[model samples]
Target: MIYNKRLILAHFWLAFALFGVAILLGEWQMFIRSPLHGWLRNADLYYRSVTAHGTVMGYVFPTLVAMGFGYFISEAALGQPLVGRRWAWAGYYMIIVGSVAAVVPVAMGLDSVLYTFYPPMIGNAFYYIGVVLVVVGSWVWVALMGINLYVWKRAHPGAPVPLAMFANVAGAYLWGWTAVGAALELLFQILPVALGFATTINAGLSRVLFSWTLHAIVYFWLMPAYIAFYTIVPRAIGGRLYSDSMARISFALFLVFAMPIGIHHLFADPEVGAGFKVVHSIFTAMVAVPTLLTVFTICASVEIAARLRGGKGLFGWVKALPWANPQMLALALSFVMLGFGGAGGLINMSYQLDSTIHNTQWVTGHFHLIFGGAIVIMYFALAYDLWPHLTGRALLNLRLVHWQLWLWFIGMIVLTFPWHYAGLLGMPRRMAFYDYTAPGMFAEGVSVVMSTIGGAMLVVSAALFLTVLIRNHSAARVDPEPFTFSRAVHEPVSLPWALNGLGLWLGLMIALTITNYGYPIVQLIMTPEGRVPPVFVGGKP
Candidate 1:
């Protein structure tokens, strides 16, 4: 832990810094589009900010945090120093360099294609190259995670790997495979057009390849948060994890179900057939099983903690749990938001229901509720828990931390509820401005007003969160003990190969991905008519 302290700190700080900038960009973008702020509107600038904000928030922040958190887990859970400390640093450099390269073009308005990089709306080649570099850097971390675990297992035979390390490695393995989709899209399709090597691109093929990475990447973002739920939160709240076996099963299920379900994202696209979409949709629903398992497992774990504290009655267990503890509060709130978000997800996953909300403001709202609300709240909890340990200083103010979490929760509800309503009212997403005077816009206009209010609250919440972290980082030392993780109710004595190892699961993920995506990708490549000439609109700055 001591050996890799600087490495972990560097990655985390970079992630939050990007997060801060992105939040401000988000608020600004929303404000400019609102009726209250017409003077701020600039189509070019708005899209540029959108591109930067999405890329930083979606790609940069999550990837860095996951990598840093994985490194810390490897050392702490495995009880060993990181094996490839130097290679880890090299990976960090690649990410840093890649981020700058990518952001430069976006900042200059040369790559306002948004994070999706949907073609034939090609951005500069530098943008694609920069993104590729970031992926390559993460792959290095993935390799390190695999090597570290293999070495540890060889050293200690017939022992169940520490649960936290086991989950972390699972996330790494998931990302390594998941990223191939977009990486291929960039290398073969987008880059060629951006570089003038090709006159046309198969837009359908590009979308298909991206669909490969689109949804699974959410799981990659989510794994660390789930790790916190299973390992950190229970212990922080004074309870043991409900079942070790259930946790392992959840991770395994996520690996198997999450990879092949990306085709669900393409239900609106014509190139993919109905049979494939239905198959993908089934797998998409299957992905929810792990989440359900986690919800049940974590709640049971929390109840145990509450009962341990002498709470009585059916729901009194919830009240008996610690509310003041930021980590505990974060867990409760995250689950609540996840419930709402997950329900929305079920609506989107359904073929018939999705047509109602597809490409509307509701889709954006659903995502924010899940990613920003459910997932990011846990990230805050993680930071709060880790800050003291990493800095060797107690947090400067606990009250501020508590307030920040509540504000984030409240703000998210306010922001997303209106978004969902407006989406249902037939408001389109990604629009720079809406004509409030247009026919049938009364409902949309009202929802926009509500959304603006919520956006304002979120901006305030983001400011408070950053302030707390900055103040806490500079505080004087108080605690001397290192941070600890939760233990399981029944710790494993021995585990099966499937739960304890990756060999079997990784193979399954590959076969499933091929079965799901191989034919569509091949057909796109082989058929000349599927290709369309690339049209580059956002020119180099």
Candidate 2:
């Protein structure tokens, strides 16, 4: 029943608004990659678009969603108002300013390093400063989540944190750790070169540092979606959560294992040794642990709902459940994409298999399916579920909402499936053009062009989604009951501190990251690596 209408609406609106823009940019980039008139055939514009597209998608949109959704969880799950209202507003404005500052430089072709740190190829100073501001703003939100949780615990000393809130804080801390590597690189190395304080940077070290942030950041984006899975989806399906304790363990496991596994991203890079890469690959596989746990728990919860509704016999429950409900449909679709994406990811975790697809379209397809298809479907569902509560407007028309979801799901599969095929056919990524007439490239040429149709489908889906949200304002209003999360079959009343509080997990996560990253980072710094001079983007010839 706790609702902070303006506060919640502000955060959600900004996040999705930027998401809309990023989607348009993404489709254009897709077209550019296609043989469809070569998408204007300008490399400068293409790289600019890539940087803008990646930055917003990777940093601005996801971070804001997490932050906004974190605020919503704080108030709703805790049965209290948020403690740091002014600070939250301050953080939002910082992100807004930073997003503009960061993206403007990208659009001007002055910061075309393309999202990840490629430090020996420095971009504009404003670009790095802008990103730093966004990170700092997110850090403020992280502090607020901690403060809110502590305040709640003080009032109810022995209680288990609500599952949603627990997951929220878990993600906050996870991101807090994840941002450090990027922050260090920008502060010490990239910024120095950009501002003319230093002329050379160790490119290997930049890649290593960015690798630390790279993979874990995906889990951070996935956090809100996963939160929707455990906390909201079961309730939407009219089922109680099967096991609250299991949910807690999954989130905790992600916190412990997600950060260390970033090394697996460096598997093809020479900066890290074979032993460390092997260790990281082993640890990276641990991600599947929590993922499997989640799959089991959610599927069980859905089965319970089906049986309660008088679903009879094996698999009949699937029919009894409400596929018409957007939340239900989104969960089913999200899981479908997750299956394909996760399987593709398993290839990357293997050192030899990873080498086969490194910097190829296959990796791009895997990323898009996982994040765009699986993760983003739930973001849509979460937004639909919360909009009514925030605006006191009834949810959008079921038909339109369902159609939007279906289009995105189908379009994503159509788009990414081809990328995987083209990649296997020796197609490289980040190119603005491809010669379709080249011998033996017929299949690859066909793949990229066909994917453009998928891109167009996604763009249409995005438009429909925005329409659904905007149309809700003029639609009839209802007196909404304050929203609620699902019940656990046995409510988590008193739980172990390790499951409820982040204190133990935080310490353990730090130790794991240090063990994984410490030696390579220090070696790259202390020893002489071949340092390269800055090639500033859009600089003088």
Candidate 3:
């Protein structure tokens, strides 16, 4: 099926362009905080850069990439032109304009609330509005995905939806519902206070609402990578998916389990009781099951491919596998990093262990590894794999792609490992300066130096990534095979509605969310005295 290549390329290029900018901002942030760069210390500038870096990387880049990738998969994997191309373009522009609107305030030092925008620390009203617009734009995508799937189902009757498109739409559905928490918080709580219509804002309540979106949003960013693992990587490596049913079950589990777990992030906060925290922590552990399933499934698929290539013993298949293939290498490295990240997450989810590292650099390292390291390496692989197909031009250099992936892997390890160590050694997060000259600060200085070096390596890797894309775009056109997804080992002839449909999962998510968050939120709403007046950073208000 022919896709609108221009549309796909436009979204992808914009996403990566922002990623390149965020990479530089991230390095600058680490540099200014280090002891050696004390002369460059400016708290205002550092926080602003941190806000912009986190916003771009956490919200803008991944969402755009997922949306763009979804559109491509809708057409390529499902063999149909997108049902709402005009709407998709509108969404693209909305995201671009919204990102600009949000970013301008941060750049001007008017809004440095950071990506989470925890209130009663408020920013300019436009920042909140800008974020709402981005979510609104994504909602457009969510609607379009549903429409396309509905239309496809009606057209093809009982035929099973393509697994890639099915999973993509499931992610869209999940985001549609999950984003409502943050959206409502902005509309009801943050916006009114930011605009000065309300003097007092409920900080605890805002945190609760944002938490609804926060943890689940990671799954939103992660789904595309998971989509690639189940649908694209297997085929790329000459293997079939181990189980279509397992893939469906994992995605379903994510939709149901990923949302209610956000309260685990609030274990340190006083607004919520221990009961709610324990409930959320248990759900947080539940979320890990799907990830484990994915790891096992993907590994099994790779093993099948390796065995076909002639492997004798139990682990000989690992050696026989295609180590040089960029996608294969990325998958292996992503899994390794994910293991490290997951172990840290286990600590965070434990009520007892969380206090040890809460608000420390350990939390920062864990998320960066999972989101920036494990998830984004797959994004890099996707770009390399898809660019040629979308542009009808061969990649300028495969060697450059390989080098970029390895550098990214190495850089992330160097960057995050020290953070984990230093976090244990009592390094606080979100601080602009570390005071290395102070008593008992020598060990912290060593970690800071290590982080700065890693940050530099990451910037180098980012440059190489952009170079590969630019060179690929300018390369001579060449014919390549149509991009295809792998079939499951046991092809799904007919799926139960529970497995194939979204309604059952969506209802369960709503019920679970209400059961978990309803009481605490209602309690806060009833008590006006609990609300606190806004405090504007940088003396703006």
Worst 10 residues of 1 by lDDT: 33-42
Every candidate's lDDT = 0.89, 0.89, 0.89
Candidate 3, residue 162: Cα displacement in angstroms equals 1.1
Over 4 Å off in model 3, which ranges? 39-41
For candidate 3, what is the lDDT?
A: 0.89
* Clash pairs for candidate 3: none
Model 1 clash pairs are none
Assess the local accuracy of residue 363 in candidate 2 as a C-alpha lDDT between 0 and 100. 90
TM-score of candidate 3 to 2 decimals: 0.98
Candidate 2, residues 280-377, lDDT tens digits: the string is 99999998899999999999999988888888888877899988889899999999999999999999898789988888899999999999999998
Poorest 10 consecutive residues of model 2 by lDDT?
Answer: 33-42
Query: Taking the tens digit of each residue's C-alpha lDDT, what string does model 3 give over 1-541?
Result: 5478898888889999999999999998888888778755468888899899998998889988988898998889778899999999999899988998999989989888899997899888888888888888888899988888888889988888888988998899889888988998999998998877898998889899999999999999999999989998899888889999999999999999989889999999998888999999999999999999999999999988888788669887789888878889999999999999999999999988999999899899899999999999999988888888988899877788788889999999999999888899878999888788788888888987898898888899889999999988789999889888888999999888887778898899999999988997898788788799899875555
What are the RMSDs of all candidates, in order? Answer: 1.2, 1.2, 1.1
State every prediction's TM-score relative to the real structure: 0.98, 0.98, 0.98
